[model samples]
Target: MEKHVSVKMINRFDTCSSWFHHLTNKEMSVKRLYRTDACGNRFCPICTWKTAKKNAIKISILMEAVKEIEGKEFLFLTLTAPSVSGEELCDEIDQFNKAVNRLFKRRNVERVVKGYIRKLEVTTDQEKYITEKLYKRKKDYYDWRGLKVGDPNPTYNTYHPHMHIIVAVNKSYFGNRDAISKSEWLEMWRDCMNDNSITQVDAKKVRATETSNSNAVLEIAKYSAKGSDLYHSEAVFDTFYMALKRRQLIVYSGMMKDYAKKFKNGELDRFKKENEDEYTHLLQSVWKGSTYDSKLRELTQEEMEMYNERAKFIEEGDEVE
Candidate 1:
């Protein structure tokens, strides 16, 4: 990260979550606030894990709610296209996204799948199409491939961009004659892509089991791209940065859209309170959960003295790390 990001970013990472502000209300309920670092991208393992976990929770909420409705079916779908060179990655991603849009718009797809949580994942493979830094990408704003005419990043690999979608439909979808079988899914994808040769897809009905749901959710909500791929080389990192920087990795549509919007807008009130930082102080918190364990009551004489000293330093602009 230091090599790729600015010095300011490095400094932010250094102090991130180092001193969490613990806030207490009149009721003595407490919540801790951790500072967000500049390294909030997928490259940061902390942020990636947090994001994956958050998405899992969000999906769980949606799925659990959807399951309450009668006659709902869930399908885990994987759609793929052939691997592309780094030089063509951006265009390929654009095309893939457009193809997905077209597929969703098709009458057959829209008629069956009422709701969906769509996620895009990109993986790199060196074994199949392994090569050196031989291909020069059309655009390299950072010149990650190096300035020298012959010199480039250490290695290069082909990229596979695919979709992991979880779609919900009515129960009749399984029995309907026009139901989307594996071959039908492939046909739809192939037609949408306008490529007859491209035919890689995996679609399966998800059993309404806790383990099955958990597995499907994890597969869909896990990191969009691997951290290993990002750190492979400057060239590879740059390719990812250009290809995915501003793109939405996960999307919620149709029936799922309202739930996602509710989730995002804090209809889920815990989110607003939990994520918002009503920064208080270097809280004298031995307080555990909502019970207000130890920190809620009056402090001992020694504890009071320590708190005073700390508060004094803070007021004097001499904060102790």
Candidate 2:
């Protein structure tokens, strides 16, 4: 199974510990907290749903930004190569970026369609297993006795690790046109992929079978506060939404109980509702799932000491225990 970290679980522990520390020392104060859910599937549904919801919000934000810049055409591209170790994969990604930049410069289309490389990482073994399960199948043969079981479907051993690119094209370049043709765009994309010295999957084939009409939007949504599948087909969104909703409800109940002790029930409910509504709207926004770097600021002496301690521990490869 794919391994993923659980941000919610960690935060839960951290919050409890912080509260305990606060009780012991009245002067103790809480610092800014950021929660990152582990990508692994082992975490509770609460964490997963929260992560997914955040992703949706991020995507919504990005879409809004893109919409603001009028006359931009979006293209979804994939670059693939043989699977390799994580370090090598990172290097390849850097090289691919340089190649893309060079190709765009030469074509004088750099400004027209800028390429954004979102994720570049080695595919996990678990992902490979799942892919195999979904693609492979047993066969059957027609015979006098009706249908007879045949040999297993042939499996392709050439599994290529791939990266996805989302390119936004300036609509001004295609002046007076709604969008570029699939074949024309595919040819350009193929050439760009080849120029980057990256393995190119057949864009035409993929596009032909793509179920979603807004592939670029969906790609961005995948990384957004809500999950990518949320914007997929209605059926898929319904199924995923229901599952996640149950988890969120449980978490909400716990949060309500925790707050009830400190504040009036009506006031606590209002506060919770406000947060929930804000988060919901954020998910619906165009910049659904994205992170911005925090502004640089000086750290206090105590903060510096804590940072140094954490760094030393990390460098020594020692757990807090």
Candidate 3:
């Protein structure tokens, strides 16, 4: 019997490999916070968690500056193309990124889109799973070329690469002459993709105002692909790791570029000043289902004392590593 396995679910069977946490207390509030350093490696699940937290902060800061503009709005968009085999995976991502750049350059899209942040992502359709018995019984039938799975085409069981973009547009864009509706956005995406291989595409307007909610923007800033989705298959992992080598996974353009520069110039102080009563700290966490366990339970007396000492140093203007 052919066993079905999910590429996305393989991480459920794996445990967190790294352990180290840091905590901090709010300046004017009693709230405590925790966070950890992210290695920023594409294949590390533990680091993926940390990266998501860091990215959320970054996107939030950007949105803070964005909301300052009078008529600007945000749109969360998912852009996709045809799935390609492992061999073609690397090149396809490059093509997809180039196409996205071209997409923004178009008069129709450019007229409405004032700025954007884009990230690349990938997924696989797990066709079949091989059992030890089957491998031993028909050892000659399997090979690294994906032929062992029955398809002679070595490129079978391909990787699906796509982009999740957060676009900033003028509030008037929806009613403008070049305004793109949900359906029109998809068609424009296909036209930009410029490949017969592309058949499925999607985009929708998301709430990104000052009052509604900003979680949508934060979600768009998360990792290009989940660690769970990439860690199961060696072919997928290696291909992606090499393909994205030296590639900029996230990009910001237009007025966003200016804001990003300000952020790089230590704009974190702005966030701290704005949210003085909030705590931002590190934690030792275990990845659960949808989120990680970040709440600090009970602390030993010694640990509590150490935390207090560190907090005192931070309040005294001494940098704590």
Candidate 4:
């Protein structure tokens, strides 16, 4: 007799029941949704690109907004540290800002120095992988848009969440030419990273090889204006809704069936122990209180196809407006 392979069927309604039961009876529900469709390829890539482009445009606008102030020079400085606990990371950023601000005041250059610190938290896993990859390859990993081949690798090993300080130096001292040399800026950055304490860490003069191209920036800007409107369009919203519905159906039919079998076989405890945290979090994110509904009203299939076509054009760098 030949051994047979058996395929199992999942009940969608049962999956929902299990999810509901877990939510009502579990000790604690997960607080965060680790999985999202934001990265799904089935989703419009143009919409994704547009969102990023819009953000860049917004930042540029904000930077230019402060440019009109008389006697001010913009300074862009990045502060980095080794990856640590999340709370500690946040504290380090706060301390860095305070130290940098104090240093500016103590220097008393007599120009109105005003600035803000934007903290970017790098998760440990991502930091570790990036650091290791850079170390092994001896290459500096610039932003996606700025990436290039054959660059010297960053020396830092650990993922340290860091802060970017956009300082506007008073014109009376630094001058309007943005006269601060890269070395001077790096020293200040290193000092701030060290929490103003003396350390053996040498402030290496790393030249920024990346150059900003206005054409690339403008191209991004143009796509962003088109993408934003398309994303909120009825056609796009319908596609999103359909995808979400399909995902929900698959999870319920397949995942719930397996859970029920284990529960009946007195193996539920073992399975639960292995995936309780992840399952709880998923349920909380998907069906915690409110049912999932389309944010935009229904659209014709033709409109949906058109939105997707526009998205394709944007991704290919074609002229889109």
Candidate 5:
């Protein structure tokens, strides 16, 4: 399955670097380093990596900024609804977002859970996630949570589209008479969605003692969905791609407004710049986009060497805007 996905991805991004200009200065001396054009296709693995890293850094900084506030606690919440076919996938995602926004706006909810960061995630139905473990001999490879699988195809069966939210709450929340219980949270979520048919909602405290690696905030700060899952079926991938067309994957509330602005305004070192002399001469290897026995191949060795010899490096201060 993974192999098939890789083949498809490589083919899809075969022309990613079809055209690129070497980093150069006003003097036209190219730097040793070069960058490929990000295709910006949502399901494209390469583009997704670049986007995820940028989001992670932004989220981490926001989390740090808010941690200094008193009475702050984090909760890992999962909200889900019934699966939808390819036709309904896009609509369902929009509805999901609306319902979540409604859940947060409720008077009772705002008193306790003051702020939140929500991320959308999708996984293969139960059979693909659960039963596939039989193929692995190592027990550690199995998913121990014992989650049930659902349909594999988005066109026919229900495809799982859910949100994993890192909710911030006041430390004194439980002391209030109106504080909600775990079950009540689930009920409220169901009611907000206006559909009591699907009953899977989770809300749990994310302890402050937890390590950054295990912290719920950092976990959901990652990619919106697994790349492998999107590779399952083109129909499913298309469904998600269309649904998330203009959607914001991760969102922060209240205190994060200023932090978001700073990050977006280039106040952060989102992308590392290579020192001027990191490499006097660097090899530039890219796909030629020509077919070789029905497979895309990198530039020939001679082509790479010739290009490297002609490229010139410039001083750091001379970098072009």
Candidate 6:
């Protein structure tokens, strides 16, 4: 019923990667297969999963860096106001981001938390969306024709947008006598938003694991919105595109802001080590719609020599005289 890019999105996903290269070392072990032609579309399920995994790894690197520097602590915070309609979604998010900025600017807030990373998430309510559509007698319209929104609780649900935040702090934040309490945080958020109706706020310490990475950061590194929500209907999809397109969903503040710049410079990014001396060759595979048909074959002597020469050239990074 609405103008959307669903057709284009479907086409993009259908032809995401037609070929995959399987690489193996001299040890005869398959190093993971390589498929680099991903469409990189945010809505593509395949690309979204890939992005999430990469982000999780990069964020873990950041957490590990923090851990190395005197064992800094982390806290996962969830702030909610109220759901808004698709029409109001974009502006609502703008206000949400502003309120978060206002909260961080507070002397009290700045005193305890060191740096933070924030992620914005928008979700749609399919069941309630349809039920309400009929109730409002929307005559085959699009753009959430007569959707009811702004209700903290709804019969089904509406377009619910919220923030998932992770704040890094010093070790003494929790043990100090002047530490902030749970109720105080709720009040501060309400004041920042200028909406006393904001009652559902959650803040908790990130529990430590044997690994350097904290599990709480995964919540921040995940997708900006649920795939199920967008694929529910054209209206939902269009609304999300309009609301989130060109918006900065991930945010870093204070000391974390410096880390963000470092991240892009590859300082905090993770890369797999490739050994050129191992003499690895690639196995070619072609996609047959659902599955990849392996075209495995032992390399001929000539092919092996070619692979070695290419690897040597790459390692040397110079042309032969």
Best by lDDT: 6
**1-321: candidate 4 lDDT, tens digit per residue:** 011111221222113322221111123433212223332222344334544454344334333433432333444444455545433544554565466555555453223345432323232332223444544443333553354444433322222444344444454434435355555555665565554432222221112221122332232233211333234545433423332322311111122233334444644332221222222111223343556421222224564344434333122211223
The full ranking of all candidates by lDDT, starting with the best, is: 6, 1, 3, 5, 4, 2
Q: Write the residue-wise lDDT of candidate 5 on 1-321 in tens digits.
A: 223346655665755545443433333454433555555666667667666665555565555545553346667889988876667777888889899999999888887766777888765442333343432532342334333333232223356689988777776664567667778878988898899886678878766665143457555766666777666676666655666667887877754555567556755433323343322233334455563121222445574555444332222222122
The C-alpha stretches of model 2 lying farther than 4 A from their native spots are 1-52, 68-71, 85-87, 114-117, 125-160, 172-215, 221-321
Q: What is the lDDT of residue 122 in candidate 6?
A: 86
lDDT of 6 at 95: 87
User: TM-score for all predictions?
Assistant: 0.68, 0.38, 0.66, 0.34, 0.64, 0.76
Off by over 4 Å in 6: 1-13, 25-29, 129-157, 210-214, 266-279, 297-321
Cα lDDT of model 3 by residue, 1-321, tens digit: 012234443443243333335454433235433333334444556556656666666677776667664367777787888778777878888788888888899887887888887778787654455555545654664654344434443324668888888788887765677667777767777777776545556666666443233656555656766666566677666766666657788888886777778777865445432323323433456656676675454556676656655554232112234
* lDDT at residue 270 of model 2 (Cα atoms): 24
Q: Which candidate would rank higher by lDDT, 3 or 4?
A: 3
Minimal lDDT window, size 10, model 5: 312-321
What's model 6's TM-score?
Answer: 0.76
> How many clashes in each candidate?
0, 31, 8, 3, 3, 0
Query: Mind giving the per-residue lDDT tens digits that candidate 1 earns over 1-321?
Result: 567678987776655433333433445453332222224656666667777866777787677666664357788899999888998989999999999999999998888888999988888754322123323442252255344334443333789899999998887788788689999899989999888877679998777775233777997878878888776778887888788877888999988887788766756534221332222333443323443333334445574455444443121111223
User: What is the Cα-based TM-score of model 4?
Assistant: 0.34
Flag clash pairs in model 3.
33-281, 34-281, 34-282, 34-283, 35-281, 35-282, 35-283, 142-148
| Model 6 worst lDDT run, 10 consecutive residues | 312-321
lDDT at 57, model 6: 60
Candidate 6 versus truth, CA RMSD in Å, comes to 8.1
lDDT of each: 0.68, 0.35, 0.62, 0.35, 0.60, 0.69
lDDT of 4: 0.35
Provide the lowest-lDDT 10-residue window in model 2: 276-285
